[model samples]
Target: MAKKYVDINTLKYLLYDVYQLEEVLNQDRCEDHDISSMNLILDSVKDFSDRELYPYLKEMDEQPAHYKDGGVEVHKQVGVMMKQGGEMGFISGPFDYEEGGLQLPMMLYTASSFIQEAANNHLTGYIGLTLGAAELIINFGSQELKDIYVPKMLSGDWGGTMCLTEPQAGSSLSDITTKAIPQSDGSYKISGQKIFISGGDHQYADNIVHLVLARIEGAPAGTKGISLFVVPKKRPDEEGNLVSNDVTTVADFQKMGQRGYCTTHLGFGDAGECQGFLVGEANKGLKYMFLMMNGARIAVGRGGAAIATAAYHASLEYAKERPQGRKLASTGKKDPEEGQTFIINHPDVRRMLLFQKTVSEGSLGLVLLASKYYDLKHTLTDEKEKEKYGLLLELIIPMVKTYPSEMGAQSVSNGLQVLGGYGFCTDFILQQYHRDIRIFSIYEGTTGIQSQDLLGRKLLLENGKALQLLTEEIKQTINSALKYDDLKKYAGKLGDKLQEASKVIQHLIGFAKKGDYERFLSDATPFMEYLSTITLSWIWLEMAVNAKNALVTGKKTYSEEFYESKIHAMKFYFKYELPKTNGLAEVLLNEEVLTIAGEKEVFN
Candidate 1:
């Protein structure tokens, strides 16, 4: 069979069946929309992505934004896509209908966004930033602020960026030195330099709204003194028309990948002073910024997963079409009659494909599940249910953000490997996919940061309650799978893995309190990886059970080949992917190997 982009039917199955999005739509929060309507929106976006976005993907990577004279210029193609995306209403899907948004469920919105990301990742960054900014305004800004900003942003007349990182303070928000001084008006004058700001400066939109984090004058040091401000490139008047603002561009960064979106160094107060309004309360900037960061983190994770999925799909197509050496068992050497078989016939190629499939699909399923939880927390009528969903989301955020990021990169790398020498060349999209996906594990919070957040804050502060809740959910999933014969053995295996993972989590918690904090922290990344493996395994098993039920009941029509492929992916995950947890668990239990006291100069 000819290789193609992502299998649309498979995507539909994963979204509607595996994630139970239809059931989520029936919830009170989404009572206004039905599955058909949601599907229509998604189908349109998918079609647009396939036709309009995918073709420019390679060109955008090759012709990244260039810095000149005091501003950055992105590929002209990006502007076209941005305008099309804006016109399609994708930039405002989750906002209120009165604000020109479709008011779609978060799950559906995320699913649609995933298609765009898969088609062209760098182009998608613009939309991600815009959505993040709009969300920050909706959550924290005043009614007056919303009146001035939300409609313009929703209409795609403007774009947004998060300005938090500095040359000195990269990840340590507390160390940031950006200054915000109060003016006669309610607004503040923000003066600072922010670096690595994505979508920071672009011609695609009329103006750029920067959600900046800066400290107030004479305020106590660290994050407590920091406040979030709405700093626009051109300050809007009472009627929201553009007015002069003292925002300047210091430089634009040339990155390793995702070049279509401008990463820039922005200087405020360079010309004079940038007028800004406080978001939320003073000295609580980190709190408000976290709301946006958390949302962006999930978005980055989903972007990583989408890139991996696209690469896998592309590689799968390439493997099936590209003829190579015959199967290993074919001993006849020089038989021109036999000719060359497709690379898919090779075991190594199959291994790479399976690895990509397991990671990409599993990560996609996990992210969609998390997005559904976001919807449930906001939409569910039952207070306790909402609380449960919220806690679960909190516990899973680190995993959802980090796991897909770490594994998604690995998946894309394997995808490149599937293409042999072609994968290494710039001519193929796999190379660009690898470059684009590599940033996932680093941005949004490095894997290390997420690990510390997971163990230090999420697990420890809650007295392990969040983790326990997640364990129970996995247990319930396994319990439900017991009735299905196809999944019984896999469920038992998953149960054992979960039990082992649970033990590791408990042991790590006890170790942390024993004053061996360094030793315990040393294993945080591995522990996170272990937890992610088990969690994704449980999710894949749940999906497998659903697939099996569908197959048995004949409720949904599927080709024998497709059903077999689904079963193969599930088995590949369990047989090949799940067993790695034991090794990760071993490392968690014995942290001594990593805690070896060595001087930094020793390696040098």
Candidate 2:
């Protein structure tokens, strides 16, 4: 059978060897789950996605959600998929058992989510919003608030959205003009227009819960004045029944991709005062939102990675089946006598396949590793270990979010190139994959935003503690590799790259501390790229080490071809991929490459 998604062998290697997800199941915090249980859950999720969700993918994108007669209408097929997903308890996987969740570890949950996302990206948005909402309420909302809303969201009886953007306040939250008037009761009346609110107003659920950021009356100005509110489409009565809350939809944005989800323009308190309850403390909206944003950001990155994996698989399948040309080395004229061979025989096609393999599998390996850190942060009982993993997560979050996103989009575009004209046409799936993956860099946060966050906040503000933790972890991995004969050479090269990356980061830190903001910001993207490349290289090396152990131990059954392919992927990344760091480091050290001083006309 043709492979429609990520290769199963690659998935097995990633889950067992690289991530060691089974080890996580044994952790005390994950006592609720064992490997068997987790595998069962994953199997169910994979089946649902393959059978129910994958079939509707093209139809959702082609038909899209449309706004008419005052309500946005999502495709009925998407609604069915979401309802089935909810029935399977996927939307609530990370929630507490008391709140209708499966009480699964975040690692297992995120791993399952990646399969669903790869199978169908458009429909995953609904689940994403639900998870985001559940997280926010569980973290900061009042007990009453959690009691009232958490279960409904988890069950998909209701949908949720984060309403932070306004017409004037795109990236600058401090400039928002949304007003919140304090009422005689403790609640406030929220009045404002919010744009780009994903899943803001959809018919998939009975009601929509908007986690809005607005300024309360008499509150201080700037971001400090902003507060988060749980504003629902309808107010629940004494009987806990929902009624119109006066929040109305003004319009829905017509977007370029991921059109299955509703992106609405919302007007709060238009018909009557929209009642809202505060979440957490006043003036700390951004901090609270960051909790949700951080999770969502990583999720978006994984989504991008998943799409790239799908596109690569699709292109590979097409290349293997479609007969096109002959081997370049063959001088035999017109193989018409022998019949045309498959495109896979062409060296150029092989090159494209290798490119897609490295980026897609490399991204999958990297993101899953990041999710493992998430599991450690939550599941580790040792305070020191938790803090250590937390620091590492902070340092790598930008890369995990930006690197896969940026590279995933590149991989999908290149996958299209491998297909030639068919890739450009709507008849093939690659065109839609290209359009879908393009949104990754923009959502969660822009690539530039992630770059600035890495250099400005993660690197500089922490005084290099996070980077130090990461270096120690990589060094430990390298030290372990010394015991393995097959991995020693690869580990040695990675060690050298680690040293180079660290020196560059240290120099940039010193430069920034000396008030060289221009020099510091100028090298930000290169620094980010260098760090990301090195991190992924380190992960690929770790996988290589594990593959060697698998071959030597003979503890499991696998073909020689599988291990050989794994080695090839590792070697390909190091040989063809790691050299980019040289250019990146050069860009950082030399001030000439800084584009800030370039003319505006040059930009044009």
Candidate 3:
């Protein structure tokens, strides 16, 4: 078992020093909770993660949830963990006290989630989806609908799923064919099949609630006419009895990793008796679903970073303990007096380790920034303040989802590489982590989907205000770093990248304006890569400034090694990763249409 999931010093540095989460806790929306209480909660969660979750991660991957009889049967440890999460109120930590929650700030809540996800993502998925479902009802469901659902779901007596994907549609949600027809009792009969539904049909809960998206009869086609429904595996009768609701589990997906979590294919109204209650109104389901989807997207980002961070630490420990070949200088020397050196001393191994470190730590920082923006958007009373944060959040969510996922996949792969042959074996945890994080870029929203959203909608919408907000933040970071001589060079480099990014975006916007969208969006994936690289550069610069301040002022909050390590990591990113944006931006500006339809005619 991995004794540590994440570096405690890094977590504390980012939470208290860089983000100032304590101030966020003191805000009007979350004033009831203070830093000391939040720290205690965090300490407890880390203990749970270390003792309960990490030990079972390997077992969960080896023995996944299986389909039997009529439902999916998961590992017994899953049940125990779910119950503990509920009883401790971790599932509802971000909600209000009136809603039976601890009402911690989103930053603190997210930090706690990061710890658990790093330990075991499969176990965390159930509670994450349940909280997301209950929050959906709290925001858009009617009072009666809330009465019928929220409590049991939050208490972990029932599991919840967002039933969005269909066999034929996949990421194209508008093509979903699920049907919800109205009945005499104001409920609708939901009939459809949903696939890849996580926590869809687990035995840990007494019943499962599926937030199904289906079209009402006589409604328009496409997403404009779809409505959301709350359909459960079992229904309540007038006598307050539990009865099967004709919701059937078709099969359980045998996944590569995160195997202990149930991913199911479901059939609704197979016997024509699956009744569901409407969430809001007809034709408005897609909008309401976005509330849950947006939150899930950010969670997916956090999971990617969390898992990769775990892999990095594991690899670091292995490198320190497993002594290997001699240093390059002594390779030819065959004297018995000299002994083998540790792998950490090798330049190439050190390079891979540094890459993993930068991606994991930098991605975590980016996600927390997004979480803070989300809190401000939802809680601030000032319209302008809300609007600023809202636009900023809207703009970066794609990068928030895509960058960590894509980069974390690479980061974990690098972690495995650092272990060499041992990484390929089942005995080491890196193999499983590599498999687990692979799904991050593919789920919630695929990288392709996120790329399109970045170039097509987020960049183009509101007449470029979203991009403007992003650049303004980057520029502000640059200004702060200017005062420090050690960081000014890297800050200037980031400024140049920002200017280059702006130029490419302006050119692409012109193509869209002139009805050349084919060329405008052809290279969207590369554009996403460019934006993500620049965004992380900004974050690294901010962190570097803070690290330097601590060192120069002789602050003893952390050891000198800690601050020096931070500075070195920042330098590594600028030296190696930041340069990636230049090549990607060049491809975007050159306007080469190499991958368009006509260019592939010869192959066919």
Which candidate number maximizes lDDT?
3
- When summed lDDT is taken over every stretch of 10 residues in candidate 1, the lowest stretch is 1-10
Q: Can you write out model 2's per-residue Cα lDDT over 1-604, one digit (the tens) per residue?
A: 1258866567767876678887777787677787788778878888888887777778888888888888898988657755777778878887767767777876777778888888889888887887797788889999999989887888778888888899998988999988888788789898888998888887778888889999999989898899999999987999988989888888888777787877899999986568998998888888899976657877988898899999998999999889886554357565655667899887778878887888888888877777788888878889998888778888888988887788888888888998899999888889998998888888877888899899889875467788888888888888867788877887899989988876787778776779987777776777788888888888877777777777778854468678777778888888878889998888777746537675545654
What does candidate 3's lDDT look like per residue over 42-149, in tens digits?
899999888888888999999889999978999887787778889888787888877767777778888899999999988999999889888888888999877778
The lDDT per prediction is 0.83, 0.82, 0.88
**How much does each candidate deviate from the true structure in C-alpha RMSD?**
2.1, 2.1, 1.5
**Which residue runs does candidate 1 get wrong by more than 4 Å?**
1-3, 237-241, 330-337, 591-601
Backbone clashes in model 2, listed as residue pairs: none
Give lDDT for model 2. Answer: 0.82
Provide the clash count, candidate 1.
Answer: 1
| lDDT, model 1, position 590 | 76
Clashes counted in candidate 2 amount to 0
Q: Work out the TM-score per prediction.
A: 0.96, 0.96, 0.98
lDDT of 2 at 343: 90
